[model samples]
Target: MELDEAIEKRRSIRGYTKDPVPKELIKELMEAARKAPSATNRQSWRFLIVQDDDMKNRLQEGITQHFVANAPLIIVCCLDRHAFTRQLIEKRVEELIDANVMSREVANMLYQRKLPQKVEETGIPVSAYLDLGIAVEHIVLKATSLGLGSCWVRMFDQERVSEILSLPLEITPVVLLPVGYPAENPSMRPRISMEEIILGFI
Candidate 1:
């Protein structure tokens, strides 16, 4: 499908058909997401595709979001804190030096003293969350191209999701995507005009 058509047609769907999404389709979606660019190319994102009824129910129980439990497939997007932190540290190091916050000599000494601690801080998951957001956009667009319906939901309980999924200490869950065939056909919703969206070009 053309990118414009896919973008125009894609909508956040709440209702879904009873038919299950095939595993191969899920694989293709992830493959497309794998190609999305990341900040400093950190690629610190991972996904847990959940189809188990019990697990989905458990997640839904903790989350107040109404639509999350109804879909046939729920994908949990996770951020790898370690990877994002490494990228952030590398990106910021030169900036610190360039700004003259530290001399090269002092920077080198500070790097040796603080780099590890900085890396540790990066594993907090916000970086991974950014990575996951990009990946999720890729997945949603790909799904639209494939005539599948998906909704990016942010209404789940973080602690419950983390415990239910047994997510590692360094990883954080960002968003949940419920995937299936649409049960309702929705007309295009209103959107801001391009003139209203864009600013002066300078």
Candidate 2:
């Protein structure tokens, strides 16, 4: 499907059909996430599929939105805790320079920029969260392209959900995705005019 069509058609579906989403289709949707780009190629996002009935009920315990439990599958997106460490980014820079992926001058310029520190001052999980966002979007869009419906949900208890999943020490669950066949076709919502949103794009 065309990217434009997918973007337009994709919506937060609160209702879902009882039709079971095949494992093969789920794998295809996740392939998009696996191929998503990450900072310095760290691939810090871990995708967990939760389909067992007992576990799904456990996930919905802390969440108020009961519709989430209706989804045929839930994608638990976890971000690695150390994705923004200076050492790992520096190693990537060295690799890029040595492998001729980028010019040494460019790499040195990046190293001297200290972008991560600036982001840290603002308390943003920059590299890692940004990467996680891309992966989550990929999953949703891919689901849309393949005639599946998905919703990006965050209205859940992070601690409880993480504990239920038995996530590792450094892996943090950032978003929940519920994927299944849509029970309703929601019309596209409004968007700001380009004139208002675009700020002097070159």
Local distance difference test values of all predictions, in order: 0.80, 0.82
Q: Which candidate should be chosen as best, given lDDT against the real structure?
A: 2
lDDT of 2 at 131: 86
Model 2 quality (TM-score): 0.83
Per residue, candidate 1 scores C-alpha lDDT tens digits across 129-154 of 66678899999999988889999888
> Per-residue lDDT tens digits of candidate 2, residues 150-178?
89899888888888788866677888898
- In model 2, which range of ten residues has the least summed lDDT? 115-124
- The number of the candidate with the highest TM-score is 2
TM-score of each: 0.81, 0.83
What lDDT would candidate 2 get against the real structure? 0.82
- Candidate 1 yields a Cα-based lDDT of 0.80
Please report how far candidate 2 places residue 61 from its true position, in Å: 1.5
